[model samples]
Target: MATPRLFVKGTVLGYKRTRTIQRPSSTLLQLEGVNVKEDTGFYLGKRVCYVYKVGRESRCIWGRITRAHGNSGVVRARFQHNLPPQSFGATVRVHLFPSSI
Candidate 1:
């Protein structure tokens, strides 16, 4: 049974950060069912979007998956506009575009 979905679900763990610094331009994410480092390879260069509700309207923040974040299947996303702090722990949609699939 094939579905009509065109994207995958991703979680915004947080922004790329260090012990004393954080870079909002680089956001960290984890895609559903992608639990291995090698599995993340296919997602590289793909686009990602964070959707949020604003009163009765909706908004989105677009980004691209730069590379695998670590050995635990985490991925790093770079956006033109830095994701707001409120996006932390938010659900993002990973699109299989750029025809890389």
Candidate 2:
């Protein structure tokens, strides 16, 4: 038997540096579970962390108006790479670290 390494915990704070052409791309969410420089954490798959894109003034930026007042935004996180692609949007519990290897 082998022991599993535990990841850290926190909420998503931003979008992934790269994005899809038709939709908001996912990015690294800033973690609140530890110091600002710490890179390890985990998330409970059952809940969603609110995602709001903001500008220099910290005002929410509305990329598009799908409805009368709708904005295009996104939330993303880094998890074990072996997980399937469908797992991208699904609520997930993740163990994140500084490096993939």
Candidate 3:
């Protein structure tokens, strides 16, 4: 019951496989690979995405950080059966690594 934290890497700012309430869910998302370090409010580069709930309805990839509540940053990955095979708009090429210590 303790094995759900898969995020090979990061930087994939695009991907969506919608469908819920019934079934089908697969999420391989990213967007949080740009840090400059400030006061510690998380706004260095601005962009949050880390949803890794591979197909089977076990979703739990949420995100939130509104300065006051304007809205433009959100990664609501609510899966239930199938969502993660992107190619809708096309422009994918996300590669980020640095965790092999």
Instruction: Judging by TM-score against the true structure, name the best candidate.
Output: 1
User: Per-candidate TM vs. native?
Assistant: 0.91, 0.25, 0.19
lDDT of each: 0.90, 0.31, 0.32
Clashes of each: 0, 9, 5
**Where is model 1 more than 4 Å wrong at Cα?**
none
Question: What's the ranking of the predictions by TM-score, best on top?
Answer: 1, 2, 3
63-101 per-residue lDDT for model 1 (tens digits): 899999889999999987898898888899999766654
Candidate 2 lDDT over residue span 78-99, tens digit each: 3322223333333322343333
Worst 10 residues of 1 by lDDT: 92-101
In model 1, pairs of residues that clash are none
Question: Per-candidate RMSD vs. true structure?
Answer: 1.4, 15.7, 13.1
Error of 1 at 52 (Å): 1.2
Better of 2 and 3 by TM-score: 2
Per-residue accuracy of model 3 over 1-101 as CA lDDT, tens digit each: 89743332333333333454332232233334433223223332233333444586543333322231113332223323333445222222222222232
